[model samples]
Target: MESQPESHLLKLRKDTKENVRKIYNLDKPGRLEEAIKILQHWIQKQDHILKKDWNADYLDKTLIASKGSVEKAKKQIDRLCTMKTLIPKFFEVINVKKELPTILDLAMVMPLPTQTEEYYRVILVKIDTKEIKPEFFMMYFQYCLSVAEYIKTHDYANGFILVYDCRELNLAEVITKISTVELQQFITLLIEGYGARLKGIHIVSESKAIEMLINIVKQFLSEKVGNRIHVQRSIEDLPKVVPKGILPVEYGGNEKSIKELQEEWLEAITSEEHMEHLKVMYKACTDETRRNAGKFNEEYMGMPGSFRNLSVD
Candidate 1:
């Protein structure tokens, strides 16, 4: 297998790495190395895990998401593999070149090139059409996971800030198409499976349907995360919460236009090198037959399909 290539779409800021090291207490002599070693050993011992050769960079990001807790990181890794195994809909077909272009045509969900002053990466999700199909939601979820996977392997950041542009959205059309059960699973995969440390969720819209949309989405979020969501009356109001300078030119910022950013990301993610990387990552799922029955039941009792009553909180 070929080694994963470095990311050309996104680059860590000059001070970002140093800042993360200090904040995560990785600056101490051998601290980060020791943590990675311990996690590596645990992975080797887990018989159910099919892909145990996770690189140091991957382990380091897992630790950062766990906030330096080794125990939490272990559980996170377990849940990640388990979720991928159980949820084939999201992990089964990751052919970016073939599957992603259609979804991109419908809506744009791309991470901005600029990181915030605090080093949190920003993701821009722009939904322009109201003619959303029921099947497209799953494709959208898959696209998100693809982006998250790309970030996991390449980018380093304190957390993620999601900027959702709903100016042209028809909430009534969108809400009916979105299944609560699927929503739960997608959020679980994003936070637990991918270790996405979400910092904020900012919705940009002027539609009266904003309230209804927020109410529905809030059900899947914890109080802490729910509180982080803010609705902007207009794009002009966005800079109040998110920096204007880092935003796309369409959003009244200095950066590239949304179209340009999206095109660049599309090309980068669909490149032959990244496609190979995704092929390897798709095999990182666990073999449930090999997993201890008791441990499996204990850890994933509340997984989406296991029970009708699901709560991400």
Candidate 2:
């Protein structure tokens, strides 16, 4: 007889954590390709669970597979390809180096041998398990159009990924979603300008990436801008936020692991002595802050001056 447990969010989180640990602990992994087989088995298991009227089990199983290896991950996606089935809180762990650059409409990094110009890569990853709806595809299409318009207006050549092909619904009709206002303008101005094979006044083509900048800036300065959004979301650009002359992104200082920071902090700041000594503490806090800031600005952000003059107090 089959057993059933009630559904809960905490259960799903626990299941995901366990699965991620299991995957990370894979012992002397034979080949990366084997991850695909584990994923396929997971897909089958999930399909069977839901078919048996076990929603909670289905969700737990799906979350586990979501964090599996890329091949397994892609197989996990087989259970979720439709826009109608996506649940909003869903998440999948993916490696930035291996998975992201390939699944999108444009490659952010050209393959090794090409002459493509290199530019800073900015990306935003939004994870949702929102029971995927057909309307969601429309939302994605609009977002892509907006991104393209922003890029074009700013003279930036960036790439994007809508990444909603996880639910079990057929994503084929995503075509319908792509026919929004921004894409329409891109077709007329960019595609037609280059005499493209237009799709009857609907659909975005590769050429429309040209207009992403124009639309993005307009929305940023317009009523559409919101507090929740950022132009860049990945921590990859963290070091770059500070001026680069002093601390470089590639330098060992800025890139030091969290363990190293904790060690350094413990070695220097004794609670009693630093607290009692005012001038010594002031010089340590202010001068150290300035030095670190100066290093960060000169080396990471390319700022002209060190941040020594700015007083913390």
Candidate 3:
């Protein structure tokens, strides 16, 4: 018999008409309600949470990312709440007014206007190392967190396809300049707490030096995620993996240019509403009383020792 098509692996369906919850297994009509009840019980049982840091949308995102697994979503939220105090270097409060302009100038994270047939949102990362400074690293990470949060709230259950454009980058310099601890922290959160599926990572216009970069990155990521990293030697070859229609004109697609995409994202992420939401997110993380109540184990509080061991300065 011929093997099933790979597209079957990405297939999703509506779990319930009332809730609009999508999942690969649609047999459970009450999955969303059951997951929400489980999360609500966990929230009430906790001693902290002076302001109720989360809402239904937050729970929905966590549940959807966990594929309707209440146990997994609970663990995810626990890690998320504990992460801010545990990793202040990356998860602490960021002053958007002071940081947003520089972040926009140095890096552009543009989510493609359309999703793929599998409903995966495409995100393009355009970095200009020439404009980046030491302080901009954390800002860049904060911007990424903002983007992830937006997707979690707005996109329902969709995963992501990340394209890293390294066309004009000084590969060696950029890699060495990044902090190992911070990089590990970011990767840990992406894998553990972000509550969104990272479908694939596509590296385009890469240099010969990318092998070293990949080796270092794979140390922090699992074999499964490592396998998902695709290196395209030339822009012309991107369509073999990423469809041409989703790419920008420079990459043989009809979407907006990098500059236009950058400006659009800058406006979206810096709007008054988004800025306030970011501030609230930071405040929720910094609540010491709330975090103290969780009482996470030393090893489980932040980056696992195994992950730390993978970090090379």
Candidate 4:
């Protein structure tokens, strides 16, 4: 995969880089570079990985996401490639313009341009229409992953804060349409496959049924992650968790409106350069035949391939 040009990449604040390094215990001289080298060597040795030539920046992000553990980074990379190979439905047809318009019309999922004081990138999900469909669950996740792919290459951050604006959402209607199996798969892919370090998840809603939705979501998350979820009775309370300066104007902040940000992100993911990049990335899957039989069974035997008989521990 071609590396995004330096000029196009998001510029990280000098202090943000230093702070993240310190937090991840990668502040020591040559420590981060050494970890990247070790990860690169490990990838080259893995016969199952079809693409061993991963970019340095990609390796760095993987290492950071692993919390400075080279071993965990190794597992993370293997799981990601394995999922890409097994879950063809998610990886196939990544053309944003052709495949995502319907879902985009129902809701907006975009990473805000600014970072919080703690340096966590906030991703805003706004559901505007009451006409929710069952198929939208997958498409919504696919869109989020598309944006994540962009972040993997261009941005630097400590973790992510998800702001889910569901004020207009019909939770009772959505619950009936959702499949528990697919819900588990989406959570797994987000945390395990993509290595998303979720600092927090803020759900903005006034509906009493919001608790029902939260209960369903928590079943798929670890106790620690479940504890990170905060329910907001109003958008006015958002500033207490996510700072005002970074939030969009609609939420009583100084940044651009969510509509504007959504449009900009839509344009970006559908851009010719990014579309070609997604096609190349969708091909970075594992070759199971080349993998060690014992290791493959030990690692992935429990996983539900193609969403058949899915079970989450």
Per-residue alpha-carbon lDDT of candidate 3 for residues 106-158, written as tens digits (9 for 90 to 100): 67888876557666668889776654356677788887887766555455435
Clashing residue pairs in candidate 1 are none
lDDT tens digits, residues 1-313, model 1? 1112476566567788677878878868899899999999999999999998999999998888888788888989988887777777787646665766677777897888778889888899998887888888898898888788889888888999999998888877887788888988998888877778889998888777788978887887778888988988889888887889889999889989999988888787777877888888887888877878777767788777654233322
What lDDT is obtained when candidate 4 is compared to the true structure? 0.82
Residue 198 Cα positional deviation in candidate 2, in Å, after optimal superposition: 33
Report RMSD (Å) for each prediction in the order shown.
4.0, 26.4, 7.1, 3.7
TM-score of each: 0.93, 0.20, 0.82, 0.93
RMSD after Cα superposition, model 1: 4.0
Question: Which model, 3 or 4, shows the larger lDDT?
Answer: 4
Error of 2 at 224 (Å): 24
lDDT of 4 by residue, 91-204 (tens): 764766587789878889878777777878888899977877888888887887888888887777899999999988888888888888777777888888878999999999
lDDT string, candidate 2, 1-313, tens digits: 1111221100122233333435544323443235545544554554312222212323333333243344444333332231111211111222222333222222121101111122211221222232434444334433333233222222111121111111222223333333344333333222221111111111112232323533543442223322212232223333343222222123222333333432332222222332233222112111222234444345323211222333332
**Candidate maximizing TM-score:** 1
At residue 214, give the lDDT of candidate 4.
90
Q: How would you order the candidates by TM-score, starting with the best?
A: 1, 4, 3, 2
- Give the clash count for each candidate: 0, 55, 0, 0
